[model samples]
Target: MTDALSQIRRIVSARTPEAVWHELAAALKPFGFDRILYGATSNRREGSVGDIQDVVSFTTIARHPGRGREDMSFFIRTPMFRWVMNNSGASSWRWAEEQFAKGLLTPDEVAARDLARKSGLCAGYVISFEEPGSRRAAALSMIAAPDQTQDSIDAMWAEKGDEIIILAQTMHLKIQSMPLKVHRRALSPRQREALEWVAEGKTSQDIAIIMGISPGMVEKHLRLARECLDVDTTAQAVAKAAMFNHLYANPTGEPKR
Candidate 1:
């Protein structure tokens, strides 16, 4: 118990997202689950995780990117994705099976299940978390060991489900409190600073004065920020950056991975 507590403490205090993810995955390894995917969104719509660009996610599943980068947007069309967007609780992979048996699943959902079976991802647990804000949603998916059957995993869950849920919740909250950084799309210090100023309700001229630059230079910074964030306007850039904590990132520039 003391060792578990110590590990949990370390996980929460980890400075970087990579550290936290590695620790979290290590912690779950003994519980027969080694593959985990954590995803959270602050801009969810009725049945979506909102813009994929705005999602905060970490994964342990190896995508074999050397072959080809996986299209993560495909997750949006999966049954589990819809369930997380619509509900707030832990559910078994059995739910998907039952839905399929009852002929209640859509064609796309059935196809998703077939693919999961082919990929050895057929047995797992999904926890759709209840967030404090209406616009927020988070979920964690844990896949059992390849040698484990769905029935065996379910029996284990019955005995240790509460502990599993608590650990996942802790991980989600810890990740939320940490910095959000994306290696694929890191903003420059000037670009992030410009977005921060915009989020603070600063105009072009106001930001220019505050940043010690001309209005045209301020406009250029904001424009570059919008482009970096892949947003159509400064408002969208500010909203997206703030949502991901990019606005609060190190002005010294993101550290190398």
Candidate 2:
């Protein structure tokens, strides 16, 4: 157990999201776990709790064949997840307290309970780490055989809080590294203007009316922005650009457009 803890700490300390995922898989395998999933959301309103705001994974024991390499679908549809989200606060400590209060379970054990009884996971755990300087919170979940007990879970937290915190911090840092700042090279003056309006939540037609451009032109520029960001959908493109500071308007502004 000490060696596993050391390895997990080293993996997270590497400061690379990819490395963390690889190491997480290896470190968790000893406990009979097969797969792991992670997700984050700065604001619950932009999407919803349990939605994959960001993701990373490994598949040594658990084989999610046909599932895309970076897929994030598990979170959205898992059973009892809604309950977990509604009950669990968006912080690791909050969830931990609730778990301990409810069943002498630590946060990890509570998470494991959901995985086992509700999410088809035999033995599993989930921990939420709220990102610093941002409202965004990241959730890390692992699935294994249904044998981990509350004592074991609590012991892991007691002994390895520092290592787990490192993993959580690394995850948050990677999310930040993909900042949504606007890139001048990626958008023309007109396109930039259009996106700013979109970020403000204006429809293409609305933007066209506001900017005196044809609706077709408005659509064209938005499409281009999506392509530039390599995102399949316009909302995703807008989010990427906005996070990178390229979007024109602040969605989190007052009045909540």
Candidate 3:
């Protein structure tokens, strides 16, 4: 168990978030969870816990065929997601099934269940973790293989629940620390620097002086940053950049001067 945990820690320390997910996926295969879907919403609004627009999520499930479409169209229809929104910590597919049997599921939710079963995601466990003092929540779903049964999964969890929780917590922490690529957009170094200065309440002229660049250049960087983040104004760009861990990134290359 110690060796496995050490390996997980090493993987979590990877330089890129994608690398961390890949390594974490490989590590989880031994525990009978071959498919993984991990997502987090860092900016959930109060009283809008289940609203999709209020949440920004990053996930690995897009790599699976058809899963991306399912997520976009049917996510809100899933009972599991609704349960996680109202509750925290760990839950299993059995809980969702119980809700279904009680006739508590909406029609859309029933359809979502059928879709999941058709897609071979019949049984699994989900762990939801919310950040302290914030509405930010992270959920990791460990999906069993098509051939695996609920009884087998239950026994495995009984034996290794602690290890599974430890792994999930470690991965969740690493994910929150990294910048996620939203809508296939990434921030360039100069843009990130400009946004960081803006977040520090610096004007374009002030940022220009700090980075030894012209005021025009500072404005240009901020403009490009706003475009990349798909925000209309510099303030919004700065806030979004900071939310994604883009601002104040460690010195990887020389800052534009």
User: Number of the top candidate by lDDT?
Assistant: 1
In model 1, where is the ten-residue run with the lowest total lDDT? Answer: 65-74
Write model 2 residue lDDT over 1-257, tens digit each, in one string. Answer: 57745774566464434555577666656654456665555445433532232222323333654242233454444433443444432222234436446666545456644654564554445555544534454465655455765456546656665655565455445544542322123566677677778778899889999999899999999888777766788788777666555554433323233
RMSD, one per candidate, in order: 3.4, 10.3, 3.7
Candidate achieving higher lDDT, 1 or 2? 1
Clashing pairs in 1: none
Q: Name the lDDT value of residue 187 in candidate 1.
A: 79
Off by over 4 Å in 3: 46-73, 211-213, 251-257
Clash-forming residue pairs, model 3: none
Q: Which ten residues in a row have the lowest lDDT in candidate 2?
A: 50-59
Tell me the tens digit of each residue's lDDT in model 1 across 1-257: 57677778878777777788788888888888978887777877888766776677777786652111133354555677777778888888888888889998889888877887898887888899999898898888888889887898899899988877877887888778666754246778888888888888888889889999999998888888888778898998888777776766654334457
lDDT of 3 by residue, 70-176 (tens): 46345556888787777788887788889999999988889999998898878888887867846677677778887888778878888987788777888778867
What's the TM for model 1? Answer: 0.87
Provide the overall lDDT of each model, using Cα atoms, as 2-decimal numbers: 0.78, 0.54, 0.74
Question: Once superposed on the true structure, which residue ranges of model 1 sit more than 4 Å away at CA?
Answer: 63-71, 182-184, 201-203, 251-257
| Separate clash counts for every candidate | 0, 12, 0
